[model samples]
Target chain A: GAGVSQSPSNKVTEKGKDVELRCDPISGHTALYWYRQSLGQGLEFLIYFQGNSAPDKSGLPSDRFSAERTGGSVSTLTIQRTQQEDSAVYLCASSPNPVYEQYFGPGTRLTVT
Target chain B: AQRVTQPEKLLSVFKGAPVELKCNYSYSGSPELFWYVQYSRQRLQLLLRHISRESIKGFTADLNKGETSFHLKKPFAQEEDSAMYYCALKGFGNEKLTFGTGTRLTIIP
Candidate 1:
């Protein structure tokens, strides 16, 4: 079976630019999650989506970070006006339910200069 | 606030030796604990969960509520076990998990 997939495995951008990272969850998965892995922060939860309900945005570090899942399948994480501090590997994961284990993607390495 | 803590940044043991990776967490409520492993050049994947009580590839973790600990261990370490292991916890209501800093384990041959 196909696992979760993320596009543009690596991205490099200027400090003030914006970037969009995409994630395609495993087929039939109804829940999606986004996380960031920085040198010092380990892995921090970003946001989560379950069905048609409002996404859990509590983990978004700032107003510039946002994520959306469409058709209950694919998700996109956008960082607007990114800063050098945003440099890290963005990881995506999916699960059938909140209590189930999640399958993770290879991740997109974002470098903000 | 829910949090997972892996005290060791790195652990090294020879093949066929016993191995233990300590993980402690802090959460106000009952939490679901898990151990995730990432092999060389591979995506992170679930190794075992305390709730399942099933060992995967010879690895097992026990949840101790009194100590707030869920340490992963194996009787005999294998070289293939060398990788980064992360301890994670999910609270009863939260839809996402809080992870720890992770421990890099190396099983020397």
Candidate 2:
């Protein structure tokens, strides 16, 4: 079975520019999550979506960060006016439920130059 | 706020030697604890979860509520075990995983 997938394995953007990262969750997965991994720091939770319930946006670092899940299958994380601090590997994961084993995709690395 | 902690940023052990990776967490409720691993050039994957109480590839962790720790251990370290290990926790209602800074393990043959 196909696991989760993400687009644009690598991206280099200028500061203050905007970037969009895409994620395709495993089929029939009811839960999707986004995280960021930076050097020295661990994976930071960004956002989460489950079924049709309102997405949990608590982890978004700032107002510039946003994400949306369409048709409950794919999700896109957008960063507007990105900063140097936003440079990191963005990871997406999916699971059958909130407590189930999460399958992770090969993250998209974003570098703010 | 719930949080996970992995004290060691890096660890190295000889092959066939006993191995232990420390992990501690802080959460008010009974949290779901998990250990995730990522090998070189491979995507992150679930290694084990406390609730399952099952060992994966000879690795096991016992959740100690009194100590607020869920440290992963293996009787004999294998070269393939060398990778990054992360400790994570999910609170009952939060449902979002809180991860700790990962520990990179290297097995010396």
Candidate 3:
């Protein structure tokens, strides 16, 4: 079975720019999540989607961060007006349901200069 | 606020030695605890969960509610056991996990 896959494994952008990271979850997973891993901060949850709608976006650091899932499959995380502090590995994970074990993607390493 | 803490940032142990990666979490309600591991160049994956009570790769974690801890332990550490370990907690029915700071375990050959 194919696992979760993320595109653009690495991205480098200047400050104030915007970037979009894509995530393709497992074939039948109904839940998807995004997280950021930065030095010392560990892995910080960003947003989660149950089906096509996100029930929890509280973890999103600011309005500059947003996500959308279409057709109940592919998801995209967009960071607008990126800052140097945003340099981190953006990870995507998918689960069979709301309570199943999660399978993660390789993650997109985003560098904001 | 839910929080997970891995007290040691790094731990080193010789092969065949017992190993323990300490993890403590703070949450208001009963939570499901899990241990996740990431080998070099690999994506993070689940190692074990308190609910399953199953050991993976000779490692186990026990969730202690009274102490709010879920420490991962292995009786005999192997060189291949070296990796970054993260302790996570999930609210009942809420799949989102709060991960610990992580511990880098080095098993010397």
| Per-residue lDDT of candidate 1, residues A1-113 (tens digit) | 99999988999999999999999999998999999999866689999999899999999999999998889999999999999999999999999887788999999999999
True contacts kept of each: 0.88, 0.91, 0.82
Q: What tier of docking accuracy does candidate 2 attain?
A: high
For model 2, the superposed segments whose C-alpha errors exceed 4 Å read none
Highest TM-score among the candidates is held by which one? 2
Residue A67, model 3, lDDT: 92
- Please give the DockQ score of every candidate, comma-separated: 0.85, 0.91, 0.86
Give a tens-digit lDDT track for model 3, residues B1-109. Answer: 8999999999999999999999999999999998999999999999999999998988988888899999999999999999999999998766689999899999999
Ranking by DockQ: 2, 3, 1
Per-residue C-alpha lDDT of model 2 across residues A34-105, encoded as one tens digit per residue: 999998899999999999999999999999999999999999999999899999999999999987888999
Please write out the lDDT profile of model 2 over residues B1-32, one tens digit for every residue.
99999999999999999999999999999999
lDDT of each: 0.94, 0.96, 0.93
Identify the superior model by DockQ, candidate 1 or candidate 3: 3
Which structure is stronger by TM-score: 2 or 3?
2
Per-residue accuracy of model 1 over B6-57 as CA lDDT, tens digit each: 9999999999999999999999999999999999999999999888999899
